[model samples]
Target: MRRLLGRRDFRTIFIALTVSMLAESVLVLALGVWVKDLTGSDGLAGATFLALSAPMLVAPLAGWVVDRIPRRAIFVALNVVTAGLLLPLLTVRHAADLWIVYTVAVGYGLSYIVLGATVSALVPELVPADLLPDANSALQTVKQALRLLGPLIGAGLFSLLGGAKLALACAVCFLVAGVMGTLLRSGRQAVRMPTTSDRPTWSSEVSAGLRHLVREPALRTVAVCSALSMIGLGVGESLYFAYVDQGLGRDAAFLGILVSAQGVGGVAGGVASALVVRRLGEVGAVAVGIGLFALGSLALVQPALWLALPASVLIGMGLPVSMVGTNTLLQRRTPAHLLGRAATALDALVSGPQALAIGLGAVLVGVVDYRLLFGAIGVAMAFVGGTLWFARRVAQPAVSTEPAPAQADFPG
Candidate 1:
């Protein structure tokens, strides 16, 4: 813990990212609520979120840029673009046109990937090697906290002034994020240039990341676990607002409470994840994390909304636990130059399934009850955990505290 506190640059980056995320979380909720008010249709609001998720398929090109291009520029430019998008959003006088809201959300989805991959990839460059697990845990915990709090604030503000004002607030938040992102500018030189994975064609590059990932036994297992989790959790959360409103028969405040509770859980998990890794070994900790996620997801099956709080918390913690463990393994296994490509590869796997899950969730919510949906999520999670266990005993693990001589070290 003390070692984690010592990484000043990582801490700075963490603070910048956390504040940005907090504001973003609030703004997003506020924007959706405003859209609902304007259109007088929950369906349009749903459309907006779907639009946001729709861009996942197009993300590899963006991921390619993230890897090849400079980190600072990606972070800075994406922030500026986001801020610019939000500025026009402030003028959304009438959300009556579903298309308009959809367009804005599309902008959000496109810009979202830039910051996500950039920030995560950049952190390893800033922190000490040994402290990465702790740093990752520390960073994720803070973002989780912001995610919890952002909505309540957004909802509260929305209650006060309504539409244009909400847009302005969200715009200002983006502007703030842009400014904060600039403060963490370690510049392009901070990240070492990665090796060429392919002949630089977009499709070929995508394939390279995929091929490299497939060749590694450990990363493949991690991918399966994370992707399945996304399917279940993604499906559940996609319809969560409606679920809370209908299933739990709760009011808005109760919904906000559950969201915050999840954030609290995320922070708890992030803070503890490193310790879990340190004590449990990467495999043990990750398995436990996935198990928790599956169980927490099952909580959505509960009749009482309050009862789902622990489940939300469990979901929150599980995210960082699995992420940190998986990422750390990748760093240790992949060569320094291939790390970015390797990450982009993993992102595609995670994102593609989630994109599909979002559409699936949209369709499923119409027929299946939230309880049954959560049950399906739990079953999917079991598949993931089962795969991991089977893979562990048979295949070679990609990572270890001590490097193995049989496998290549740092795939240069």
Candidate 2:
């Protein structure tokens, strides 16, 4: 991990990523607060999140843009575009201007897709193959760290400066991140778009990532189950606040306690991810992480704050571990050229379902009991774990028949 961080390119990208993610965390919380204040409706506030996530459905198409453009350009463009889009928030003094928030949320969502694909494609170019796991682990740790502080910082700033000023602050963060991204050392050429007259149409281009994802057996299984996990995440996203307020008879402030506990777990899991992947292999580690997450979800059915706190820790740990394992697996399995598309495809698969699930959860939470929803989410996660485990067992014979890579074996 130390060696991975010592490399100049990786270090630069990591610093830029950390700044951008922290800004995103602040922006997300402030946007929610902004929407809630304007409309005084939980449903509308939640709808803001939906707008932010809904553009993930377009990720495959965005992947084409990522691959077609130079990665550094995309990275810089994302921050600049976001900064520009967010400037309109200063004009939003009345409820009539709420559309600007949703519009910007969609832009934010699209920016996530573009940035996610660009970064995934750039990592291999910036670091050695052997260091991929450690690099991903370090990045995950940064994200977890932000989870602990970003919301609190954003909420505090919103209280002090009001939403318009808070939006300006986040926009400044993006501008700084864009400048930092410009300092990254240029590497390989991004995948070029075919200009042949017979080139594939737009729809075919959009589906390219999905096709690649489905063709790789290991990636296919991980992508499918990860999509399931995202669905569970969507359910939790809508219900968790209500669970804290209504189910536990606590104020909304208690949600931060759960988030903090989860951040603690995420940090621990991210620090341990490389070791876990080395011991379990990517597939086995993912299965274990999924099971752990399921166990945590099941525990959420408990009404006690103490129980919920620990359960959130389990959830936080499980998600990042599984994510790192899956990401490493994708990187190892995919060719260098297709990395951008594959990453975006995975994003499209996972985030699209998650977005839909978030919408469904919003509606369902109004009708269903929070405990029952938690139970259902737990069951879905367990099902995903079982499915992956079963697939692994069945594919054992075929695994040996598959040709091994020319490089040294992974430390499984």
- The clash numbers for all candidates, in the given order, read 0, 0
Model 2, position 93: C-alpha lDDT score = 94
lDDT (C-alpha, whole model) for all candidates = 0.69, 0.81
Report the lDDT tens digits of candidate 2 across residue range 1-412.
6666667677778888888898898999889899999999899998898898788767777887877777778888888888888999999998888999999899988888788888887776677666777888898888888888888888898999999998888888888888888887754464656779878887877777778789888889989898898899887889988889887999998887888999999998898887777676677668777887898889988888778988988998987788888887877777665677889888777777887898799999999998899998999899998788677642232222112123322233
Give me candidate 2's TM-score against the actual structure. 0.86
Evaluated against the true structure, the overall lDDT of model 1 is 0.69
RMSD of 1: 5.9
lDDT of 1 at 341: 64
lDDT of 1 by residue, 127-155 (tens): 54566678777777776776767777778
